[model samples]
Target: MRRSPFTTLGGSGFDGSQDAEARLRWFEHVMRRDMDAPVRRLSRMVSGEVEDVIACDVVNPDHIDVEFDSIGGLESIKQALYELVILPMRRPELFSHGKLLGPQKGVLLYGPPGTGKTMLAKAIAKESGAVFINVRISNLMSKWFGDAQKLVAAVFSLAHKLQPAIIFIDEVDSFLGQRKTSDHEALTNMKTEFMALWDGFTTDQNARVMVLAATNRPSELDEAILRRLPQAFEIGFPDRKERAEILKVILSGEKVEDNIDYDRIASLCDGYTGSDLFELCKKAAYFPIRDLLNDEKSGKPSKEPRPLSESDLEKVIATSKKTQVAANEYNSLRSQLVGLSRQTETDDYPVQAAISELSKLVVSQILNLQAENQDS
Candidate 1:
């Protein structure tokens, strides 16, 4: 057997040993790169999944107890929560002695996007005087099977340690899905782990922890999980009134036009969701500011601050209503408006009243009514 020399290179040239080592290093690097492919893919999928903490956590327990004056909508859900869930928690001894089934371990918030589901969850946390653990499903999910479950368990365990806490999971349907029972081993495992975590949380007398899962997709959740959840907070899209309130809340600080009528805007935005309302307000605020900035450069008084003109708002509201209206509503309205031609012949009225209350009808409807008068 020949003994190999362990020698250092006198120059940059590679000896057999050096070449072999280099090749080995390259092979190792290649293996590492190949093995890392799946991990990289998973990391990409899991990236940017943590939710920002709101002002309602264990650190600020009093915040939840104090009334949140900002959430103008969700009155029904809030009342239901206050009557059924919150009041019970206030009198724990009534349940600690096993009077009631203990406070609900979970509250699910389900609704369309932009209806302030997350905000409602925050308000609940603030009201409940509990520690708030805001979790994003992406933050827990991992390439390694069971890793997601472990994170979930850890969250519950920590929440339990800090009792009277609420775990708010946003977009929870991404993971806590309806069990398909085939091919999706990862999803199944996650659901099982979540359920186990939930059981552990509720089983304890000291576990004053409340689990809150929010999703736009309520129907997509597992029926079993839904069954277990004590209460489901139905966070529907903001109605016209709620949307108007949200708009007011957002636009409170901005300079609005005197001609801009909030009632009219609300009427026009009847079908707009809260999110759509938020965007509309943002645009309303931004356009004025941008226009003002341009006007300033030209030595003008920002065109009287362009107070959210009625036309500007109406156009925005009309665009939003077109999209926000339910398909059924849009179809129904479209049928009535089709082939409608208007002749706003005031003479047809014989004598004009101060104003026609029903002039608020769509132009198409007005034209149809006017045409009827002409024929008569």
Candidate 2:
């Protein structure tokens, strides 16, 4: 009796009896043009004949050299991540010794654009001393059905192999949107598979892989995904003091005139985020260089590079606008979240607290309605 081609390769294209070294040789021969084909093939085999969708890149611990102290402001956010992620990874023996003080399974950083969400993840990865896996939504999407699901499984398996790893999913809202009945079959399957893999990370005590995600629109995330990420922190706009601190930090290494006023510049950047502040500094730095270049072109270059002055910053500030969106829309969404939190009985306190801080007015309204309903 003749065996099918699929049966000969142990459900893969290669035969199981072949040695690992021999399999590698054959893979290398056929995949000269495409480097990822062999890896994908191997992933399919490791995933038990599941489709291959592994597009994410794994970053070694040495590459992530950013420390928590380097990130200015948001000290509270840094402290929480240290306790939740870095502490657990560094001292797993403390977590696994029958104590309920296990590390958090997943953490979410959410807020408006340019609030340093990705920066926080990098800092955590550096602090944790664990392998970092950076995954984007584009890496998860696939034209093939069931491919994304298998890829999700493969990613978790890779994380497990490299135990004590951090998987940072940037722009998580796009990949794990609110599940709907009318969703595409492939999308639904991918979501289900991703969540299942996430659950596995939580249950496996020895598997020290933490999922850290950042999103500008946390409200767009699915309820199921929110439950998975029990620890959530909002990276909102920096207060006036924080803005001044941020400006000082940004200008620390730059050549600035003695008369430049940080407090005044901070006041000018009313609604600016950490990123916006950085941009403002860059714009100010270029002004002097730009003037020098123009002078040189006209055969009137100065003796030396002039230091950035308050006039230059003021010019930039006059032309530059803050990127803050209208707050009323987010205020209403925040109220809805607080109301949902009240009904939730699970141990998702961090998520609830972050949502509650969005707006106190919404919280009061919801509480009054609940009280009136009970009285009636």
Candidate 3:
């Protein structure tokens, strides 16, 4: 007969004591493989090659030199950010060392695309003098089974080491989507690990690590993730007055005609986002250059190009279009945010009033713009 591997060292036969030892050994082996292996992987990831990982992901403050004033429009959002992020960072002594008042651990910036979400995040880091880590979700994805989770853990660990860091995840919905059974196991595990690390931020009163995320589709994010981000703000389309300010800011550096009719341009671009406005200005300015190039091609080149004219802008406006956000889609996003604001209410971030005011403003502005477009 073939003998089993389990054999008593003290005697010839395998007995109950030997069987118990063998069972204990097998249990330890399983635990190490299933439990301890993950811990070791996490440890190694956190401790080893951290600098290299951070170098790839972390954006230095010098690289993000945009000041708060540089971002035109959204004055109320800026003030809210001052109270939520900048104030605490400015007076870190008051927030550190087990004080009752603590800085917000995370903030979420959500709104329509091209409204300067990334710029706003950079401005906060610039204002606070914090290291900004731009975390790309695609970079964290791994082909191996559990490597992505390990990478997520490693990111938090690196942030802890580099204190006073702002980890900005632009378009965060793709990274922390609503959890479901059909979701890939790797992605789900990565999100869980990221959340666990985020929860730890509360335990450290002076960690100086804030998570800032921006997304156009806030409803697609996981509820657990939203709960962690206590501070939230909506960066909506600039109103007509704000649009004029943005126009002046964009044209401030350019040599343009004295009578450019900025207010008229702003009114005409009622639905345009800040980015749309910039592109419009560029195209309008190009009309003068195009004229100069045509003159040169006809062998009647003028040495000096004419200043940008109202007629040039008007011509562009005639053909140019505003990036109108869909009425139902904008309303749906606003409603979702209003509901989420109510559901995730906490003392640290009382965003209900802000959300209510923003919702009303967004609805009014978008409706007015839509009415204008329809009338025209």
On residues 1-376, what C-alpha lDDT tens digit does candidate 3 reach at each position? Answer: 5221211222223333444455444434433554432222323332343233333455546446588788888889898898778878768887675655788889999998878899899999888867677887766877878778777876777677655678889999998989999988887888888999899876888777889999999999889999998888988899988888888888877878898777887888888888888887888898788889999999994778878887877776676556664556667868876776678647444466777888778777876786577536
Q: Cα lDDT for residue 307, model 2?
A: 93
lDDT of 2 by residue, 1-376 (tens): 4222111133334554555666555545434533342233333344333222232265545555467766778988788778878888999887886547877888999999898888888888878877677775566677877678767887788777655778788999988999889999988998999898889777877668888899999999999999999999999999888888888877877788988788887888888899888988887898888888888999994767789999988887776656663244445666677677788776687866765675566655765575466435
Q: Which residue pairs overlap in candidate 2's backbone?
A: 9-14
Instruction: Give candidate 2 regions above 4 Å deviation.
Output: 1-56, 325-376
Worst 10 residues of 2 by lDDT: 2-11
Ranking by lDDT: 3, 2, 1
How many residue pairs clash in all the candidates, one count each? Answer: 4, 1, 0
Clashes of 3: 0
Q: Stretches of candidate 1 above 4 Å error?
A: 1-68, 88-95, 257-260, 301-311, 318-376
Residue 318, model 1, lDDT? 46
Q: Compared with the true structure, what per-residue lDDT tens digits does model 1 show for residues 334-372?
A: 444432223345555433332232332564465456446
Tell me each candidate's TM-score: 0.63, 0.71, 0.72
Which of the two candidates, 2 or 3, achieves a greater lDDT against the reference? 3
Model 1 residue 87 CA deviation (Å) reads 3.8
Q: Which one is best on lDDT?
A: 3
